[model samples]
Target chain A: AQSVTQPDIHITVSEGASLELRCNYSYGATPYLFWYVQSPGQGLQLLLKYFSGDTLVQGIKGFEAEFKRSQSSFNLRKPSVHWSDAAEYFCAVGAVAGYALNFGKGTSLLVTP
Target chain B: NAGVTQTPKFRVLKTGQSMTLLCAQDMNHEYMYWYRQDPGMGLRLIHYSVGEGTTAKGEVPDGYNVSRLKKQNFLLGLESAAPSQTSVYFCATAEQGRNQPQHFGDGTRLSIL
Candidate 1:
């Protein structure tokens, strides 16, 4: 069984500040990792994903995540935060050829001016 | 392309009542999934289909039943509603292969009184 853990339940950052959200996964083999964001009352939108390539993967909305096998982590990072970047973010892991995804408990980001 | 669309964006059901949620995709995807999102609980997969006429249980499938009779449609049914089942349900679709990203619907907010 695969599982994901997000250490932070809520985070607050000021505009123009750097931000990083931690994500860790427990899986047997090389896992497919993904980041998703959800606004209030809306469905989740895919931010980025890491399959098997460069350690650093860029995503939409000026976000990126680096996969670190040694740390079992795929933390999402942004150079500077914007007010509109506030949302609930989730990290997920899935097995190869598997149709299901195991998701973390999510981290709610709050960007303040 | 309308991507993925779910019907009845909001619904309120009483305990013991039954309801079905419909999901349609225009992306010609071969895989579709049903997931529920609760506060701090990211998204948990309830059921999924690899293709038409095939359904499989996901991480959380106890109170949900699913069917995929058509390649572009997936239906999630709640036999008997419960307060514990009040959450946001999202439907998503993806192509058949590794590293493919899943497209999500706007989600249906369901509340059981």
Candidate 2:
């Protein structure tokens, strides 16, 4: 069965600090990877996705993710996190042209100035 | 623009109560999905629809029923609610493409007592 794992349950970072959210997946083949962010009382927004071609994919809101095929991981990163960047981050994986995705447990990010 | 919308932003229910969560999208998307978010569980797909009048089960479809009678609407029903069913429900939509990312709506918070 395909599954996504996010090791960190919570992460706290000071404003302007860099951020890294780890994600690992177990799938028979390379899957489409995605990163999403959810704010308080809000729906989730897609930060980025990795389908093909580039391993390092850039996304909205100054976010980026690298898909490592060898490690079966798609990690999200940001150079400097703002207070507004504080939100719950989720990692997901799905088959090519698949209908649904398998999501991780999510990592709650807290930005403090 | 209302990309996607889920009605009943908040609700409380006792065991065995039945309620339907409605999801509507105006983007003329061919794909609509329902997911449930829980503490330490990120988001799990409950049901999805590929187009009008077509519904399918997702990863965690148990205890939930769904319908997609109209092209822009998807409905999730909990026939007999349970405490374990308490979760924040989200609706998302995507164009019928191979690598399109989904757009989400503000989630509906449901608490089952």
Candidate 3:
């Protein structure tokens, strides 16, 4: 079975500050990983995904995540987060058998002025 | 394009009541999924379909049923609603591949009172 873990429950950052959200997964083999963002009253949007490519993957809205096999981590990062970046972020892993995704408990981000 | 849409953006159900949530996608995707989102728990897959007329159970499939009678639509049913089933439900679709991004719909906020 595949599982994902997000260490942070909530994160607060000021406008123009950098942001990073941690994500770790437990899977037997190299698995598909993804980052998704959910805003208030809206559906989730894909931030980025990692399959078998470069270790650093870029995503929408100036977000990026690195896949580190040694640490079993795929942490999302942003150089400078805007106020609009405040939202809930989720990390997910997928198995090859049925394309079912195992998601982590999301990290709620709050951007302050 | 209305990438993915879910009907009944909000609903309140009493215990033991039965209802179905409809999800439609305009992207001609071959894979669809149903997931429940709780307060602290991210998104748990309830059911999924690889294609039309093919339904499969996910991480948490008990007390829930899904149908994909059409390639563009997927429906999730709750035979007897329970308080524990009260949560936001999201529908997602993706291309049939290893690492395709899954598009989501604005969730249905279902409250089982």
Candidate 4:
């Protein structure tokens, strides 16, 4: 079975500050990883995804994540966050040939002014 | 394009009541999924379909049933609503490849008393 773990439940960062959200997964083989963001009362939006690529992947809204296979992690990072970045973020793991994904408990990001 | 759209953006139901949630996608994707989001539980996959008429149970499928009668639509049904089922439901669609990121709908907020 595949599982994802997001260590941070809530994080507060000031505008223009760097941010990093930790995510770890347990999967037998090379996993398809994704990062998604959701605003209050809205559905999730894809931030980024990693299948078989370079270690680092860039995403929308000035976000990026690095896939560290040895650590079983795919942490999302941003050089600077804006006020509009306040939202919940999730990490998910999928099989190489599967229809569903297993998601971790999300991290709530609060962008402070 | 609408990408993905979920019907009845919000609904409230009493315990034992039944209702169906509709998910439609305009992306012409072959894969669709249903998930429920609760506080501290991110999004748990309830059911998924790889193609029309091919439904499969996901991580948490206990109280949900799903159907994919058309390639562009997936429906999730709650036969008997319960308080535990009060949460936001999301529908997502993706292209045929596992590497493709799933696009999500705005979500349906369903509350059961």
Q: Name the regions of candidate 2 deviating beyond 4 angstroms.
A: A96-98
Q: Highest lDDT: which candidate?
A: 3
TM-score of each: 0.97, 0.95, 0.97, 0.96
Taking the tens digit of each residue's C-alpha lDDT, what string does model 2 give over B1-113? 78898999999999999999999888999998899998888898888888899988887899999999999899999999999999999999988764678889999999999
Q: What total of clashing residue pairs does each candidate reach?
A: 0, 0, 0, 0
Model 3 clash pairs are none
Evaluated at residue B58, the lDDT of candidate 1 is: 82
Q: Tens digits of per-residue lDDT for model 3 on A1-113?
A: 88999999999999999999999999878889999999998999899999887999999999999999999999999999999999999999986746868899999999999
Computed on alpha carbons, the lDDT of every model, listed in order, comes to 0.91, 0.89, 0.93, 0.91
| C-alpha root-mean-square deviation, candidate 3 | 1.0
| lDDT per residue (tens digit) for residues A46-108 in model 2 | 899987898999999999999998998899999999999999999988644335777899999
Off by over 4 Å in 4: none
Q: DockQ, in order, for the candidates?
A: 0.74, 0.71, 0.82, 0.78
Native contacts kept, each candidate = 0.73, 0.71, 0.78, 0.82
lDDT per residue (tens digit) for residues A13-81 in model 4: 999999999999999889899999989888888899998869899999999999999999999999999
Better of 1 and 3 by TM-score: 3
Instruction: Kindly indicate the candidate among 2 and 3 with the higher lDDT.
Output: 3
Q: Is candidate 3 or candidate 4 better by DockQ?
A: 3
Worst 10 residues of 4 chain B by lDDT: B94-103
